[model samples]
Target: MSQVIQDKVIDENLKWSKINHDLIRTMETPGKMWWTAVLVCVAMVACAVAAEIYQYKYGLGSVGLNNPHMWDMYIATFVFWIGMSHAGTLLSAILHIIHAQWRKPIYRFAEAMTTFSLMTAGFFPMIHLGRVWNLYWVLPYVSDRGIWPNFRSPLVWDAFAISTYLSASALFLVIGMIPDMAVLRDHTKGWRKKVYGLMALGWRGDDRQWRNFRRTYMLMACFLIPLAISVHSIVSSDFAMSIMPGWHITSFPPYFVAGALYSGCAAIMTLFVVLRYFYRWEDYMTKNIMEKTCKLTFAIAMVWTYLNLIEFSSVWYGHNVYDKELLIDKATGPYAAVFWTMIICGMVAPFGLVFQSWRRHMPTMFVMSIVLQISMFTERWMIVAPTLSMSHAPHQWDILWGSVIEWAIVFGSFGWFSLLFLLFCKFLPAISTYEVKELCFHLKHEIEEEKREAEQKAKNTSAAGSQQPVSGSPGLEGA
Candidate 1:
């Protein structure tokens, strides 16, 4: 049995050592395109930082926020980023528990997207604050003035939730990457080795090391599922807790969660196709995975649409005059055009994903992913904007089109997230080397088991033929 297992372990394609080298090679010598992308991202981030500085010096009046529209694009984008962060942890945790093999390659980058987007999401509140220097006040602390933030405030609640989500995501990402980092530490020399070695944290890949790593990883994965759900549910509460008609729906949490997962899944498609092309990792990040992601996105899209209709129906059916009017405002109000566009993107566009051609075709899926992200972004904006625009009291109502600085920050966030992800790709194994090795190990084990069964069946057949006259004669006496 041991020899059979040993022979089965002889995988031509997945020698653990060879996989380390192959994956590490992706980071070895990036091309001109990689450098170019990094430079562009840095430039965008610089522009954003510069814009923020200008806004700081010039004051909140530098942007278009006012009256009923006090919360503008920053809040919307923040929500969108929060939503974006969901799919990563969801894919990593949920699929992992279900033992989905496709998740192995996808989850590494998906989890990275979660961490980077959360970092990006974390910044929006400060950017929205306009007076970002006072950002520390959001922390649960008392100054010499003995003033404390109202724990009852949804904003404060959001602060706690975002901080906690970001921390958990960072821990999850770092822990998962340790084994991969250790692989890099072993393969490199000098500074690179030193950095990877430190991150690897003395991971020697021994029996004890393996046991502890698996147990810890599993615990974190289990913990992250509820954490991920709660993070977005809390985000939804930022709106749902409010008295505003659209924002005050009981269904907002699940609605927001579905939207988040919807957007996150689309993001996975976007990154999946781009990285597959750029890294030429077709075998690992296959078309099958792309189609699977599309199916998920399509399913979630339907879910979001259903929630949209349900929310609308509840508002329309309810005798609450204010809520009914708000529903009317959404369809034909000042920013009704934005709402309709969102409908087309969010409610309508996902229908295309149902086709195999759209799901499997890289080009189509890429375009669809982009559309879905934009739709989700607009959906967040619509959720916040319309509620504020037509607040129950007419006097408090104000329409806000985001200022130039606000737009710049939005672009800057994209740069910030993309830059972090690109850096991660350049440094760490973009796909999990250790996980893939384990995958190959299991596949080898299964193949060997099948081979043993085939051998046993052949031997039994021979034995039966040799003993046919005597043994079969007893049973065949009638014949």
Candidate 2:
């Protein structure tokens, strides 16, 4: 017991200095490229704001809203951002539940992605609602007119679902950061120390604090998994609950959920590569973790492929002429190019990950991630636009594309999300410090155990060889 305790103490001490030095280094002022990127992102966001202001002064007509195709790029962008948010929670919360120790090194930035993506997603509904001032009316609160938001509406469902998810995800990200913040607090001096100290919630790393922290974190993780699942499912209902033939499918919720996880994993890789290059964290963010993430993404991609096939097959094989016509229009009409790009990127590109060596190739993975990002965005757009463009009543049919304001808002959302993430890197630990130490502890033990086993095998072989064999034994001559 004494030896065990001593070993634990030594192991804990082993990683502290290196972990602190490496992680805190990310918070230091970055290079010229980073600043350049920040300036570009800020400028783009300014342009987006200006575009929105113009749209506000004018009307929804600025986004080319027609009778049949009212939902355009705004709704598509909303789904895209919402899907991006899912990977973070899956990386941190679900992996934590499964005791995936490798998640420790990468989950911090992934969860940060979740929090920021959700913030970006929250912008779309207000954009969709031309009278953005009445945004609060979507809430469940009672008003002076004794009115309430219609609970039956999927839009209301989206309000409750997204708000709940944002709150829980924010809590999850902050709570997980506290212990690492405390580590930062102990190491820093003066102003930075005080800042981390406050953010750490006075974390002390005593037995009681750890106990409470673990329990609370576990409980929150349990809550977030279903919440994450529900948020996107509700987002799907905005289309599925509608009476439109193509939109009224039972498969949408699970399909949306899978797409969310699929795109999310790709987004993580995108951010992972950027940060790894800039921060020089090649050690913790190793090739093996990247390989695992790629493999997971490949699997989700297959799942999404199956779901996509199922949607198309169901539409074709079933007796619904309206759905079949919409699907046909999406494949052969003006949007055919978008549909094929989604197929090639979303379905075919992931197959490249089947080769283990290819998965380890960083540049290959990065480019593939970009492809998936485009494919996923187009997937959401195709889901919304093509079906609406082809109404059951021939007279109601109309082709529609997003306007300049809509395109500006899309670009702006990307800039806004990037700005938040860059600021996060500058201020907080991009990688979790103490969690890396914990990972170090487990890996150190595994290495030590393997060494001991190897030594024991060598000893046993030596002892057996040294034993005098009978003269008649065939093995004696070789020995």
Candidate 3:
């Protein structure tokens, strides 16, 4: 009897050759839509560059950086991009360690997302500085005047944390792609072959090479898990270490980490749908995988929501008037609309994932993921702006809605990130071929084993029935 496999991770009928051909074909050619996207991203990046130049020429005043609100949209966008970077570590390293086979098909692009987003995030700190040329002072180096970088400053911490995270994450991404690079080297021709060959590090896929690769990759993944956690925690310290009311919460580290993961997962969902649909990878990027992702995203969302509520309760019950007033002002102040948008989108919209149909529906999941990210962006803004807008010294209070240049740079960041990701997809293998083959092999073995067991059970039942006397013939006499 033919039996169906429930909740299949991938189409069982897929061949290894087909997998290679389909994935590599994406890099071999580009569609009109792909070119259109690239042109648009380039234009957006151009606008952002112009805005940055304009800002640099005129100084911070061009971006509306005023007293008490020095940290505005740029810092908020920085945090949002940093948070976006976390999903890659979660999917690639954390899930890899846990032996989640479903991650194999999607983790490549996710890792790419991590690296590109870090590149995007690293710019904001420098942009926030009125004199961007003086950013080198944040580096831990001896100055000509014998000045050392202030270790206590959170900005210094950001410099160290983000650089370290970017280095480790970039290494992780590149290391993970080496085997695939070898495949490309062997398959392609001319210049592409030469490039891939150099990148593959002369990988021959021998037993020794495989063994070493596994060890190195596993070690890197193990290192990355804690590194990812600490990076975001340090980022949170940028605020938590401050004396400001809302920014000084004890729970800010975990809160920030949760928010980071939440945003990252939402971003992954958005890209997942886009890649699956654009590449026509339904056979590999299956609904079951999407459902699992949705479930994980929903779980993270709930955790984020819990942390948010906990912050509110801590401030409300701690009777810290400054913190309480800031929280109230967020809900009912100049930024009330943005605050509520964050609440509705971050806290409430994730509930849509709890429904099975919605989670499996690509269009619905795509829309929901974008909504969640918008919510997360606003969340970072609320965290930075509201606290700055209201302080213990009422005389120093000011509201900053950000200026056109600030908005342009913010818009350009998405374009920058998208351009990098789009280019990466056009050139590299976005899906891991060997890992997906392994997944298919193991799944096939499992199905065959189950089929054998079912056949044996059926045989035993038939033999027992035949051995017993027939009901109408000799069963009554035998009994």
Candidate 4:
């Protein structure tokens, strides 16, 4: 009899009941390490707030913005966080549409990351605005004096894109959580039950409810895929629409989208390892799934690397003196260190995943994921800084090293994201309970089918053997 082989996305022996219990337990327990992390995140957020206050009072100069280097770390950090927000769309929307079962265990946290990163990214533009009070001026609304914001400015595009993407992503997140909220509502007590009940919208898990849920979820996933793509493309247009030498490239949109997906995937890997180890979810977040994630990340890394090389090649050969000069400056000038770091981490480092052992090794994958993100962070910095430093007019050239306030604000943004995510972990299920149960159900069915096939094959072989003639007996004479 031939063996039927299948790679499990989760442990084959896990039961639906246990899947529910363990996932619920994740929200119920709070250990010292979690509390300590929350406290540290709070402190970091406080520093960021203090820095923003100082900047608000003292004007943009507090963060070292000047004539040439008008945009600095704030813009870079904005792009970084915005890129990070793509992870949820890639994991949740794209994978869901394709019915990728492995994503079920990890997509919930990735969705939350999308929302929180968008919230963090939204802060940077306001912080960049020296007149924070006039934030609404960027809106398309007209003032009483008939003054309106610049219609063609990339800032307006960002305002529209960010708001739309944020609203859609937040809605998608909440909609996806409803069934889990219903589970929590039924299982919990006190204020949590009440909160979950309200959040659940009185879900009964009846046939009609599930049918509608499936339909709505699929629709949202479909809508979000293109929306996610467009959002980052608009962000890229913030540069591409500009006449600046390096920023005005035609390839910037696709380049930005690829880079965003690459960074987002890396961020997901980092969190995947963290949640697996911290929650002891070896059965649910199995190595098979991690390996698949690594493979996808590796593929995206290659796409991003190709795009990077294309940009360099185009600039080098296109006979654009300003663009070529700026490219050379980025490679050989003060920012060369950061430029090469991006190249190594974003392009070369992902090749480690080619080794099956490294991809499955959680600790190594975790470190590599963080390194990839650091590379992405430097990439955004390189994008902004080198362009501004190598401006068309040599007299306007200046490199912004950024000030302490800028650094503090960027640091705080991380803390803020962490704090929000921690609260999400406390109150909400990081793993999709119903989805994990679905995986368990499918795995059990597959195992049973394989067993039945093997048994049937064995019985058939025995019967055939029983009917066959012996080598030196009556059956051989009959044959």
- Cα TM-score per model: 0.91, 0.94, 0.95, 0.95
lDDT per residue (tens digit) for residues 44-64 in model 4:
999999998998888887578
lDDT of each: 0.84, 0.88, 0.91, 0.91
Better of 1 and 3 by TM-score: 3
Q: Write the residue-wise lDDT of candidate 1 on 231-324 in tens digits.
A: 8888888888888878888999899899999999989999999998888787677776777777778888998999999988988888688888
- lDDT preference between candidates 2 and 3, better one: 3
- What digit string (tens of lDDT, one per residue) describes model 3 on residues 204-310? 88999899989999999999888888888999999999899999999999999999999999999999999999999988888999999999999999999999999
Flag regions of model 4 displaced more than 4 Å: 1-5, 457-479
Query: Which regions of candidate 1 are displaced past 4 Å?
Result: 1-12, 395-397, 448-479
- Full ranking by TM-score: 3, 4, 2, 1
Tell me how far the alpha carbon of residue 11 in candidate 2 is from the true structure, in angstroms, after superposition. 14
Instruction: Report the backbone clash tally of model 4.
Output: 0
Q: Model 3, stretches more than 4 Å misplaced?
A: 1-4, 461-479
The candidate with the higher TM-score, 2 or 3, is 3
Clashing pairs in model 3, backbone N/Cα/C closer than 3 A: none
Worst lDDT run of 10 residues, candidate 3, spans 470-479
